[model samples]
Target: MLEEIESSAHSSGVISMDNATRYLRPTGIDPIMGKVLNWLPKLGISIAGSRLLAVRGRKSGQWRTTMVNVLTAADGTRYLVAPRGHTQWVRNLRAAGEGELRLGRRTEHFTATELADADRVPLLRLYLEKWGWEVGRFFDGITKDATDAELAAVAPGFPVFRLA
Candidate 1:
């Protein structure tokens, strides 16, 4: 259990990244599910076959981690999307510029480069196609059927990262 620990990096001493329209849904079943998913990687099982992403905290320099669904495109490129709208992990990854994707005993460390909104259409489509049942509500009703324009409209809210 992670108690609220204060860091000197912010005026509030709590790690809250500045964002104009971040959506923080109530933490209910999410924490419990997150704990289970986080533990599964150590046992060689992915919660729904997704990786556990870990990034260094911008403020505390400690590792903050969460279950992330990794998407692989037809061209073999991979992406990480933040469906929760610029959550802590997204902010930390942006700050650290690198992180690890882990499952079981395998850990692949790579640098993360945030993709621009203009380039996120296809990736976002694939993401929604794959995980819509789990994260669609966060997207404000946009689905795989949404045109590029609609996606672009909501693109700025979701942060997509390309790992190399």
Candidate 2:
């Protein structure tokens, strides 16, 4: 079943879940853009709530950093959504349960709780509404306006973490 999904994703440019790893392989331009994103935040420039997420590597124990969008809900909950699925950062956050969000010299230390698929719909919707223009491709055509059932169907492939 997972293999079928991955095969479809590979052929259709969607999120892939293969062998319990839900990751859409990055495109050639992704690394280039990542470098730019990583650099911009250090200059105190943020593109739509962009933050440099630094978390300890699950195995290596070294800090691994990546650019992530921080979505704050109306009720003041903050979330981190892995639009490209269960990438290294997601796995690391799962293992370490805490990390830091940085912009320039300001750093916010946070503990994360991974949300269940059933609990991710609203957060995912808000995330897509805010970041879909930048990350819509990875979502298999699902958008913020997508039906709840539609979002729920793909929620398992995209991990959402609540940051405290």
Candidate 3:
């Protein structure tokens, strides 16, 4: 199992990468989709049960909000994943430590703990099993059936946060 990634950014607030260079394409249709989902929760609806995640930005000192999927495994652990990879919300949650998952009037307040790559195998599989239709394209065609080694090889690219 892998233990950690080579990232310079920690919950302690040292960041070496920015939005444009961190992931594949942080500014694209997905951001627009998130904006739409953020509005839906206000109207008491969701697409595939996604929620609006609102957290304080690490730099802006203001609420940075986006839509994210809350993954609940069979073991009952909850998680938030960045399928397109290291997004602003992921960075904010890392710096801020907690956030809220909202749908209309209902909100789930959570403290987030980012999981290291070596520890993400099973959860990655579960997430793909449940949300592949929505996020599979980001995985370079890797699916739930990908082996542990295969998943691990690409795990560093997907930032996962366990919420409590």
Which wins on TM-score, candidate 1 or candidate 3? Answer: 1
lDDT of 3 by residue, 63-158 (tens): 877777888878788999888677677788999999988888998889999998888888889889999998897777889999999988888878
**Per-residue lDDT of candidate 2, residues 5-98 (tens digit):** 6677686544545424578766667778888779988877888999999999999999999989999999999999998888889999999999
TM-score of each: 0.83, 0.89, 0.82
In candidate 1, where is summed lDDT lowest over 10 consecutive residues?
A: 9-18
- Model 2 TM-score is 0.89
Error of 2 at 28 (Å): 1.5
List of clashing residue pairs for candidate 1: 41-104
lDDT of 1: 0.80
Ranking by lDDT: 2, 1, 3
Per-model CA lDDT versus the true structure: 0.80, 0.88, 0.78
Candidate 2 runs further than 4 Å off:
1-15, 18-20
Query: What is the Å distance of residue 78 in model 1 from its true position?
Result: 0.8
Q: How many clashes in each candidate?
A: 1, 0, 1
- By TM-score, the better pick of 1 and 2 is 2
